[model samples]
Target: MPPDSDGVPNKTRRDFLKKSSFLTAAAFVPVTVVNAAVNQWDEKLASVFEKTSLHLEVNGLALNLSVEPRTTLLDLLREQLNLTGTKKGCDRGQCGACTVHADGMRINSCLSLAVTNEGKKITTIEGLSKGQELHPMQEAFIKHDGFQCGYCTPGQIMSAVALIKEGHAGSEMEIREYMSGNICRCGAYPNIVNAIQEVKTGGLS
Candidate 1:
């Protein structure tokens, strides 16, 4: 204790302690509120349940599954069925590495929701080949050395399969424009175009 004026005891420590405690509590108010809100949000999000069954024909096999609502079709294919042919390059819809045919239409599998694909047919690269026989596009790609690293080959093949079905194989420039989504970082564009043309023109063995 310190002596105050006129020999009275001063309450400097007590006053300082009281003011410090009040300031500390006031400063912690917003932090505590924010923490509480964050905890509530996490609890709410965790409480949401989404276990729904999905049925689809994947790679020529009928699959019945119970998946979470937020699961992607790409994840189901790659993570669940172990069909890693469809590479996960960007996971975003921008890159065409995860391209697959959903009911004969090319779509980014990573962007496709699993629940949305229920009862639909999905054609992956694994489904393109018959027993002991390669599809024409696969044969052509191998003949022309169309891919170097081959990560994008499956997507390219799937797209080419659909492209041929859609009758977009009229010319070289047309093929290039149609196949532009599937990128070959090894600069195998010329070979890829030749492969597509070969398959279209009966040049593939």
Candidate 2:
């Protein structure tokens, strides 16, 4: 027996070997792997709930904001920026109540994600006029009585402005086709067409 064993009492070779084998197995158990797995789990959880940064211009005002991944542009305008002129009629892409101009082109804000429109210039219905003076299209709509409930008027005016700019107002039928997406529950189609025609002719001040 070794000198170390002689000094010890009642510690048999079988018992020592078993304890040593347990210690040896524990030494190779990879504790760092367990710590790494925990860290990876934390990172994934943070990524799932983290808000993303967004940079965009609204009504010529540059803004920096943090938004959720699922936030829609319509909600960002109406709820976040308080531009409630852009109504939330359908929330889906069907109704044109959430129309807005992105980079001078009209789009259904309800269908666009806020994150996707980062760095874009967005124009809401509230951005149409200067101070207290109305936009030409707004004046035309008022003169022609294009809306009744006014719930869909903002979107309608936005679309009409874009339509005239796009040259789709060449004919009444073409204008109607292009403006079909915007629904006025008040049944003001004739007046809406007249308003658009008047604006197309450059008759408004």
Candidate 3:
């Protein structure tokens, strides 16, 4: 022990020796053991926060991807897979601009999680066409001028295709009701309905 300025003993030397010995022992530990401990901790954390695998078919192409749990189907399509045809109008799933076909059913991709769509067949606007030939609905839209700015055309076409397939496009009123979810800011509702009606009457789908 050492005396302070007042001649009173401070901490004893045994305490200092004990701390020094502990530090020295810690310093002498093997680097391999330290690295192993760190690796074990990292692996434990990785196991808890591991990314999930999603296997699905997109636009006729089979894909096996790893995605975080929070990744939405719209983001996975537009961002990860580079499929930009599916527009991201209202990411809250209101405007229906991110519509896509999943397992033959029309789905709001913005609201569907990528993980939930595992093993499902996804079809976007790009998948509607075969090679260089345009789908009949595409041709009908072009003929009827169903869009102005074309921002919502992809979602509209996707929904129209699904509506025709599901036998919901029986009349103009039915088309309007089914397509009400897709909001075209350009106000091309009449032309869009005409295009869908023509395709439905012609049995082009």
Candidate 4:
């Protein structure tokens, strides 16, 4: 009954007793009820929320898509658009196997959220060719045997194209430094570098 600093009756013991009683009651609740409540809450959220609409162009095709906010560009391309040439190697942006071009700049699609790329242009490996005519970089890679196992070819090609566009393919050292993000486990670094050099020198605009 004693008043505390807030000029209210001290209810510490009362609060503790109330909490204890509630907890004791909760302890007797069946696990099924708790699980059902959680499931119902999740279902309600899903039913109430709407998927985000993303307007973007991929491989010269304008796409209007509905996706969850959590969807990544990699998933949008590979899972939804069926552009599986962009390999999901590490999926952490470390191996660079999921690399793609967003608005003419190289990016790790795996780490880039699809919602963030709304209204942007995306280019995957599948976009690099026109009918039977391959992009110069793609041709160079094939000629140079730039990949073995071929898991990282897509990312390596994308990065290489961007490297030449960015004017970073001046030398072998520079190419290696810039293209270091794309890792090839097949020990084809030399061939990869050669392919990039050929493309750079070939003047492919």
Candidate 5:
């Protein structure tokens, strides 16, 4: 900036910075308008991801919901249905933390799509017990100290119950083979096996 008639610079550094900032901001869309555009775009994206109708019984409670095709049964349980007892670990089928029962069959909820189990009966950890009483398998797990960190306990119990019902708990090796899907990081395998044996032998009521 050159000196003006009065010997002062035409614009001080502070004045130049203020004007430059204003010009820079003015070159873009106004914040309010940009925010509105972003919101509209989000709505369009959501509409593009069409939601399918889901009707099923979870934990004995009948529910009808709208979910996206990509929505997993684990997400449907924990997120929308508020069934947090089924843990979401690994997100992939590798971890059995998201185990649940669909129409009497144990399934890795994370690997199963919500829309694929329409009109099915789902059972979660929360569905095991009656009021003020724990299920036999749940009780057995606790009695046998089947869990340490306990993150894998729910899946363990669910799988154990199904294992007994499926007649796969005939021996120690059978139990391990059927429960190979569930990985317990805390190394509670021995205790878990004991609990399943007890339940299979009709040891716990």
Candidate 6:
């Protein structure tokens, strides 16, 4: 910038930068407007074809649901079927608090697509009881105090039940390794393992 007669700069770099920023923002205004408009159009188009139907057995009850194809199994269970036992920890499948049994196998319900669960038997924590009688795993957890906050208890019990049914609950190390996916943030792992071991080895004492 040219200096004035007083030997002072007429305009500093900060002033130039402010002007340049305004010009740059003005130039990008049209692009921003167009992008927002296109996004709105894309969202509308995507929502248009999202409606879909799925049939699955949840908690021993047959359910035929009409939902968006993008709906996850967790949402289907919690939002649609009112089964809130499955907690949503990390929706990206990193956490296993949303674990459930599908077709007798444990899977992260958050990552499972509702549309793909058709004709599959889905078992949640709510299904692990007969009337008022608790399942063996449930009883074991209660007896052993397997959980502290109890947020992860449902998924843990679900996974443990499936493992017991599959005869995978042999050794303590084996149970820990198998149950690694279901994390207990409260560090109640020892007691949780003890509960599963008791239910598996017929030694609840």
**CA lDDT for candidate 3:** 0.85
Cα lDDT tens digits for candidate 1, 1-205:
2235786654354455544544554577877546645565433433233266789999788988877767898998999889999889889877688999998899999998888898999999988889889988999999889899898889888888888878998999999889888887888889988888888887754
lDDT of 5 at 113: 94
Q: Write the per-residue lDDT of candidate 2 for residues 1-205, one digit (tens) a residue.
A: 2125557734465455444544554567667445545555434444444567899999999999888767899999988988899999998878899999999999999999999898999998889999999999999999999999899999999999999999889999999999999999999999999999998888986
Worst-scoring 10-residue span by lDDT in model 5 = 41-50
lDDT string for model 4 (1-205, tens) is: 2237887744465455444544554577776446645565434444334367789999999999888878899998999999999999888989999999999999999999899998999999999999999999988888889988999999999999999999999999999999999999998999999989987777443
Model 6 weakest lDDT span, ten residues long: 41-50
By TM-score, who's the top model here?
5
Per-candidate Cα lDDT values, in order, are 0.81, 0.85, 0.85, 0.85, 0.86, 0.82
Q: Give the clash count for each candidate.
A: 0, 0, 0, 0, 0, 0
Evaluated at residue 73, the lDDT of candidate 1 is: 88
- How do all the candidates rank in terms of TM-score, highest first? 5, 4, 2, 3, 6, 1
Model 3 TM-score, all chains together: 0.76
Q: Candidate 5: where is the Cα deviation over 4 Å?
A: 1-49
Clashing pairs in 3: none
Question: Model 4 Cα displacement at 25 (Å)?
Answer: 23
Model 2 per-residue lDDT at 19:
44
Writing each residue's lDDT as its tens digit, candidate 3 over 1-205 gives 2237997754444455444544554577676446645565434434344467889899999999988767899999999999999999989989989999999999999999899898999999999999999999999999999999999999999999999899988888888998988999999999999999988888455
Provide the RMSD of all predictions against the true structure, rounded to 1 decimal. 17.6, 17.6, 15.9, 10.6, 16.7, 16.3
TM-score of candidate 5 versus the correct structure, residues matched by position:
0.80
**Candidate 5 clashing pairs, residues 3+ apart or interchain:** none
